[model samples]
Target chain A: MTAKTTDRDRDWAAALAAANAGDARAYARFLHAVMPVLRGVIRARGRSFGPDQQEDILQEVLLAIHAKRHTWDPAAPVAPWLYAIARYKVVDAFRRRGAAVHLPIEDFAEGLAAPEADPTAARDSAALIGQLDPRSAEIVRAVSLAGESTAEVGARMEMSEGAVRVALHRAIQRMARFAKGERG
Target chain B: MRTEDLIAELAASGPAAPALTPRGTGLRMLAAVALAAGLFLMLAGTRADLAARLAEPLILTKTLLPAMLAAIALPLGLRMMRPGARIGRAALWFALPASLAVLLWAATFARTAPAVRFADVTAFALSECVGLIIAIAALPMVFALRLMRAGAATRPRLAGALTGLGIAGLAATGYSLFCTQDNPLFYLTWYGAAIAAVSAAAAALGARWLAF
Candidate 1:
């Protein structure tokens, strides 16, 4: 949209158009020209990521550009299309990392003191489990509430680890419904 | 893994790639359309009324209209093969002939009573005519898509649809040779539907195969 963007698009479009016509050197030049632009775009978009993650995103955008090179329309502005691909790669990286909730340790330092476990909370968890099928309830208690590994729960229940995990997931869902005062 | 290495690899791989051009691709599409027409004529001879209909402006318009559509669409399809390229609003020009055909059909309908119009529109060979045109378009559709894949079609679905429209229009033009029905209403309804069908099918195929 800006004059700067228009210039970049025009440059890229011309370079890529030449590249598609079997000009290897032009293709290299196009790639070289795009690399820094893509890196900057990725860095700005994924500011939450570290240097390594940003590099990974940059590489992803590069690979995507390579794989989808033939999909670019030579007559259109190249920068917007290239940046759109970069944005998608960044989003994919974010999705792959899931979500991280960060807090400064300085603010939580006073709260780090050990506190007594609440019996009512434990009792409430138990009551929630009591609403599930007996087998599922036990799996949830072991794998979730009791902090037992899935392998340990599986071994104790004589079920495959995957089966135990599945049962536990269902039990947790039912427990969530119960907590929300909804019938599961 | 490094950007320089990636660029070097891409550059190195370039020699094996053929030098492609929009003009060359456009010519190939024309060849495909011609081939489809040749095959259709060889397989299904011209209609019994063809010699007589050749002199009629209205009958000649049926084939000419589609030929015009194909001519317009060919360049548009070629344009779509490149990344960043778009089939401009100029493509709307194709609709002109189609609109005229519809108008001509309306005029015919008014002149000819409802019963005669119904008889012409519901001709027994209607489905077969549509099917034959679609069948003729199939091979050209493949050729067009292959040509398109060789280029960078950023909007694959649109590119494919345009290819289909262009190729199918040509195929319909060829089918017009064997079709005895001279009524614009029949051509508008059946030919229009057949072109739409081919375009839709091409769009679907392009979405799956053409997208990177």
Candidate 2:
């Protein structure tokens, strides 16, 4: 290989190694290094979602690159592994935020309701809810348990009813997220 | 390969996310099932008539205590699951409403004079304050999952919601056992299901503004 090409390759190798070693500074370089590819995949996915969402997708990927660094197999090529994650994250973001997408939320809803009827769904359902805010946790109860109107509930709780509605809506969506044991 | 072909080749060659250790998955699933089991205890307990039951055990004041516990512990449990990110913390701060807002809403809705009762309002506000802090601490977990990169099934939104549900669900179940005992169906039909449903809804909405 030419001297420039060899040096560039060595630089990437060192960057990847430092990232794997838990070096935050090096990881930032790693994130910067991967940005072009990340943006490319995002842009390739299309600009249908507003620029903000598209940017969000990229940000999500960068954060993922940071958080899941340990999961990378040192033996594997980094580019494609990252590319897939970026792609999946963007698609998920689109589905999640009601962003511009080729498919609509209805399609997602249909799939989501595929029925988490494993009988054990309830048991599997609880811990996930623990991850949200307590008031949100309360809102989940108010709307679901008390059957209070969202507006009344929100007002009583001192929040916008619409915000309450949205919070409950997302919580349900999250709970209904019973996987078909596919992620194994 | 051409750029597109090269990219496609790269994509095709990517490996699956590293498997969470069997122990880790077991821990996660165990936590889920354990929570579910704990919740069932509480859930079944709430099936009694809370009013009549209240007569038996000072139920009115203490029955809802489990619910309160669920509110606090639930968020703490959720926060433990987060991967730690700046935006995640920010999201937690934004999630809790000001205590004044709750007072205003209560005044507007209740027939009681808005100006009169000091103790009850103070108590409620204090609990609200406590609840909000607990939530703030735990709230970050939900967003942290989001801020961290996702893998196979650990969608940040899903993770956050489930953690919240698991923590809150069991506690709510326990609360129902205590408070709604006389009216088990009351809590089940209302509170238990309501929180779960609403939490899921919030997670869904979260997919919007909380993106990336």
Candidate 3:
């Protein structure tokens, strides 16, 4: 693009080289640089899922990206790699509390197998459900899991957006409670 | 605000990009040719001044070439061979220059050292091989910062790191031909350590160059 853009590109290339070679400080710089993208993915997806816990998903995604970066080949463009990371984080959000298709036991099990199964995830999910009032869980399932947009879910549930928003908010709270295995 | 401005703002608010990737068998062949030329220069120079004459091409390749090449080329070549591992778009625009700066660092090492000898044309390359590796590793951190500021996005940190290491390894071979003196340990340890430090700094900085 502009000369400044070109210069930036060149420098980015160098940072990657350093980080790949195993520089902690360089990796930190790398992390700082990309925080915006992480935030974007979280915010964009959070609008639908409710922003209450978007930051949590973003953190998970970052950890995953950091932990699993060695598999990437150098010759390829990094966008797809990042997209893949974001996609997983978004899916994780859906699974945790957002509107998501409650997969059959077998299907969910299979999904769990692909990313090292965390016995604690299921435990956490159950715990979050415990804290939520019954009404909240139903709203969460319908809005976050049942593939219904907030408006659509609201209309189907015969409630105003305000009501839907309130219910969803409570449901997300329960989900967060489950995730942390804490009522607080 | 206008929709365009909102979109721009949103886009700017997103994670940075990290562009990374490589070439073909013919290109590999070209590298091989370059390696050969570099080797010739290095070996010729190493032998140019031995009273006892440790400068033998076959020996050089056996002891220094393979280790140096493995240390450098295997990583770089594999990256060339496997392009799918990186998430290239995540790097910031400024990062590109930052990497250039790192790569450029290798060239500076080529300047005449304390002992510029006739054989240095060849033997000196040993040092260069190590230097190049240092440059490759160091480039990404600086590159990423520059790219992030310029607004490039990146992800897949491991990919960037591997590629950086691989590139450093390859460049090191060429560099080793020029920089390596009679001491193998010196190149492996001292030079290697220096390179590692610089590379670590580069990557740490480059991480920012990529989008999250």
Which predicted model would earn the best lDDT? 1
DockQ of each: 0.23, 0.02, 0.02
Worst 10 residues of 2 chain B by lDDT: B180-189
Q: After superposition, how far is residue B24 of candidate 1 from its true place, in Å?
A: 1.2
Ranking by DockQ: 1, 3, 2
What digit string (tens of lDDT, one per residue) describes model 1 on residues A91-158? 76666432311111211232344223434444555577788889987786664445576677889889
Candidates 1 and 3: which is better by DockQ? 1
Best-fitting candidate, scored by TM-score: 1
Query: Per-residue lDDT for B20-101 in model 2, tens only?
Result: 2323532453355345445545544434455565675334433443344344434443333322211345335323322322
Cα error of candidate 1 at position A138, Å: 23
Candidate achieving higher lDDT, 1 or 2 = 1
Off by over 4 Å in 1: A1-30, A43-57, A64-184, B1-5, B11-16, B49-51, B121-123
Docking tier of model 1: it is incorrect
Error of 3 at A173 (Å): 24
Chain A vs. true chain A, TM-score per candidate? 0.52, 0.49, 0.48
Strongest candidate by DockQ: 1
Q: Considering lDDT, which of the candidate structures 1 and 3 is the better prediction for this target?
A: 1
Q: What stretches of model 2 exceed 4 Å from their correct place?
A: A1-17, A20-44, A47-81, A88-184, B1-156, B180-184, B201-205, B208-210
Q: Give the Å error, residue B59, model 1.
A: 0.8
User: If the candidates were sorted by their lDDT against the true structure, best first, what order would they fall in?
Assistant: 1, 3, 2
Residue-wise C-alpha lDDT for candidate 3, range A86-115, written one tens digit per residue: 675566566655342232223345546754
TM-scores, in order shown?
0.66, 0.31, 0.32
